[model samples]
Target: MSGIEPVEHMARISGGIVNWRKLLLIAAVTLVSILYIPDAEQLWSAWLRQEEFSHGPLMFLVALYLLWRRRVLLDYPDRRGTILGVGAILLAVFVYALSIKAGIQNTRHLGFLLLIFGLFLTFGGVTYARFVFPSLILLPFVVPPPSFLNSNLSYGLQLFSSDLSVSWLRWVGVTVFQDGNIIDLGTLRLQVAEACSGLRYLYPMVGLGVLTAMLFDIPLWKRGLFVGIAAGVAIIMNSVRIFLTGLFVEITDMGISEGFFHLFEGWVFFLFSFVVTLGLCWITLKRSERKSLGRGVMSVPEPTGREPAPMALVPVTVALILCILFLPLATYLRHLEPSIPARASFNSFPLKINGMIAEEDLLPGVEQEILQLSDYFLGHYRTGEGPPITLFAGYYEQQSAGKTPHSPRVCIPSGGWKIEDLQTISLPRGDTTVPINRVLIGKGDQKLLVYYWFQQRGTFIANEYMAKFNLLWGGLTSSRTDGALIRLSLPLRSEQEIPEAEKRLAGFTQEVFRILPAYVPD
Candidate 1:
C-alpha cells in the first residue's frame, strides 16, 4: 500500500506539470492570435493576390516544421527567460500600435515578427531562441515589399534587362535598338514591362537560398555567398529569357513573347536557374564534407522527461500582461477615425496665377481610381513664350496603406523617364526657405525639371521618410493624417535652358504655394 501511494503521488505531480505547460502554451497562442489575426488575414490576402508573395504559405509551413524540429531545445537544463525578452515584447507592442495608426503594412509585418521573437525568447531563453532563429526569420519573406519599393526596383530591373537583351541580340547578328525598356527588333517591338522584370524570380529564389543555407551545415560566409549566387542566377536567367524572346521574335513569331508559351518559358528558366545555383553551392563545399550537408544543421539531442522551469514563468507572465494591457488600446486606435478638416475644393482653384495663362486638366478616371485622392489639381500654365509649366497637387483627407500619394521619383521612372540628376534645393519663401526635391528627368530627347514637396498640415517636408514619420506622429497626437503632394515641372529644350527652366519653376511654385493652403488646408 505504501509503495502504491508513492507511485500515485509521482503520477499526480507529472500530470500537474504537463497540464500547466499545456495551459500556458494555449493561453500564449490565444493572446497572440487575438492581437495579430488581422495582420495575418492581410498577409493571406496579399499571398492570394500577388504572384511575388505566392511563396508565403509554403514558407510559413516550413517555419512551423523547423520549430517542431527544434522543440527539444526548449527542455534544456537551466532554461530561463531574460529581461531583454521583456523589453522586446514591450517594443513590439508599441511598434504594432504605431504602425496600425499610421496604416503602414510593412511595419505591421515587422511588428508581427518582433512579437513572435519576443514571445519565444520570453518563454524559452537564449539557447532555444537561437535554435529557432532561422524559423522565425523566414516570416519577413512572406510579405511583399511595399508598393513604392517594388515599383522602383521593377523599373530599374526592366531597363537593365532590356539593355542586356539588346546587347545580346546585336552580338548574335540580330539588329536591335534599345530605348529605355523598349527593345526595337525592327519588325517587332517588345517592351520589357513590369511583369517581366524578374522580381517574381528574385524574391522567391532569395527566400529559397536562405532556407537552403539554414538547412546546410555551412560557414556563415558560405551561406551569404550561396544567397548572393541565387540572386545573381535569378537576374542572369531573367536577362537570358529576354534575350531568347527577342531571338525567337526575330527568327520565329511574336507568339513566343505572350500567352502560355511565355509563361512556360519563364518557369523553365527559373527552374534551370535554381538547379544551377544549387549545383554551384554544392561544388563550393569541400569534397570530403559535401556528403554531410545537413548533418548537424539545427540538430540537438532529444531531451529526457522534463518539467517547465519556474524561472520562465516570470517573463512569460510579464509578456502576456503587457499584451493584454495593449490589446484594448490597439483596438481603440484601429477604430479611431482621423479628423478630416473641411477645406476648399481643388475645383475652386484659379486657372491663372502669376501672369501665366493656365489650362485645367483632369486625370483619367482610371488614374483617379488608382490614386484614391480626395481632391487633385492638374494645370498647364504657359507664359507668352517658352514651354509650359505643369503643376499637380494630390490631396488625401486620410492616408492609409495603398491609398497614399505616389512619389514622382518612382512615378517618373515608371513612365520611361530616367532621372538624370536629383537633389533637394531650397526655394526662398518669405522669411524662411522652403525645402523641395528637384529632379532632372529625360526620356529620349525630351527633358524636364521637376520640383516637388509634401505638405502635411502647415509643415513642408522634402524627405519621404520624414513625411511618414510626421504622418505617424500626427495620427497619434492630433488624430489628423491629412496631407498633399505638390509638384511643378517645366521642360528644357537644351542644357543651357536648365537655368531658365529652374527660374520659371521657382516663380510658378511661389504662386501655387500661396493658394495651396486654401485647397489642401493647414
Candidate 2:
C-alpha cells in the first residue's frame, strides 16, 4: 500500500507536468501566429492569386499530417530541449523584422519556416527535431519561388519546350517554322507564352516528389534520383504536350490551341508523368521494401513511457521574450511610410531632345492598370529620316510585393519577342559611365535593341539583384523606396544594321540620360 501511494503520487505529478508543458506550447504557438499575421496574409493572397503557388494550401495540409503522424516522438523519455534553439529563434526574428521592413514577402516566408524550426527545437529537442525534419522542410514547398527565378526558369522552359516541339514536328514531316518561341505553320501561328512554360506542372510535381520522398523509406541517393526524375518527367511531358498540340492543330483546326481540350490534355499528361516517375522510382527499391511501400513509412512504434522531466523552460521562455521584443518593432517598420521626395511628374517630361521631334503615346488602359505605375512617360523621337528611338520611364512612389517596375526581361518575352542576346554595357553619362542592360530581342526576322536600367534614389542599377538589394537598403537607411525603370529602344532592319542601331541608341540615350533625373527624381 505504501509503494502504491508513491506510484500514484508520481502519476499525478507527471500529469500536472504534461498539462503545464502543453499550456506553454499553446502560448508559444499563439504568440508566433500573432507575430506573423502580415506574412500569413501575404502568403494567403499569393496562394489565391498565383496558379504556381496554388499547391501551397495542399502542401501545408500535408505538412500538418506528416507532423501529426510523428506526434508519438513528443513523449519519448530522452527528449531534452537544446539551447541552440534560442540562437535560431533570434535569427528568425531578425530575418522577419528585416524582410518586413524591406517589403520582401519571400524572405518573410523563410523567416516563418525558421521560427517554426526554432519552436520545434525548443520544445522537442534534437531527436524529435530530426524525427520531424522532413515535415518541417515541407513548409518551404508552400512558398512561391522568387520572381526573378520564376521569370528566368519559365523563359528557359518556354524556349526549350518550343525548340523540342518544333524538332519533333519536323521529324514527323509536319511543315513548321520555328521563330523564337513561336511555331509558324502557314495558316496557323502558336506562341509558347509563359503559361505554357511547364512550370505549372513542374512546381506541383516537385512538391509531390517531396511528399513521395517523405512517404518512402528508400536509400538517400534513390530518393534524390526520384525527385530529379520527377522534374525531368515534367519537362519532357510538357514538351510532349506542346508537340501533340501542334500535331492536333495541324490535322484539325486551331480550336485545339485553347479552351477545354488544352486544359484537359495538360491534366492528362501531368497524371501520366506522375505514374511514370513513381514506377521508375519503385523499381529502384529492394523487393521486400517494395511490398511494404506506404504501409510502414510512418509506422512509429508506441512510446514505452512518458518522461517525467519538465519541458525545457529556458529556450521557450527566451524564444517568447525575443518574439515579444521584435514583434512591435517589425510591425512598426512594416507600416512605416517612405519619405518620397518632391519631384516633377512624368507629365512634365520633355518631349524633344537631341534635335529630335517626339510624339507621345499612352499604354492601353489594361496595360496601365497591370503595370500599376504611379507615373510614366512613353515617347517616340525621330530626327529627320533616321529611325525613331522609343523612351519609356515608369516611376513608383513606393515599391511593394506586387507593385514595382516590371523588368523588361520578363515583359518582352510575353509580347512574343525572344531575347537572343543580353548583356551589361557601360554608357557614358556626364564624366562617368553607368551600367545598363542591353538586350537584342527578335521575332520572325524583326529585331529590336533595348537599353534599360533601374533608377533608385540617386543610383542607376542594371542588375535586378543589386537593384533589389539597394531597394532594401534604401528602405532601411533613408526611408525612401521610390524608384523608376528607364528604357530606350530602337528597331533594326537587318543583322548588318545592329552597329548603326547601337550608335543611334547611344546618342539618344545620352540625351535622355541628361533629362531623366528631373522626372525620375534620382
The models' CA-based lDDT, in order, is: 0.79, 0.79
- Least accurate 10 contiguous residues by lDDT in model 1: 73-82
User: Clashes in each model (backbone N, CA, C under 3 Å)?
Assistant: 0, 1
TM-score, candidate 2, is: 0.89
Root-mean-square deviation of candidate 2: 3.2
- After TM-score superposition, the amount by which residue 103's alpha carbon in candidate 2 deviates from its true location, in angstroms, is 0.8
Model 2 Cα lDDT, one tens digit per residue, 1-522: 987997986675557765666567668768888878867898899889877778889888877777787776665523455577777888888888777776677888888778877776776677556656777677787687766567678878998899999999999999998766889987888888778889888887888877777666677787788788888988988888888888888888877555534764466767888998888778777887677666433556665555445567777678778767776787788678778889898887887898888899999997787578899999999888877899999998888665677788877875668799999999999999999999999988788999999999879999988988898898667777899999999988887999989988898898888888887776
Task: Provide TM-scores for the models.
Answer: 0.90, 0.89
lDDT score, candidate 2: 0.79
Any residue pairs clashing in model 2, and if so which? 457-522
Report the C-alpha lDDT of model 1 over 118-149, residue by residue, as the tens digit: 76677666755665677878888777776656
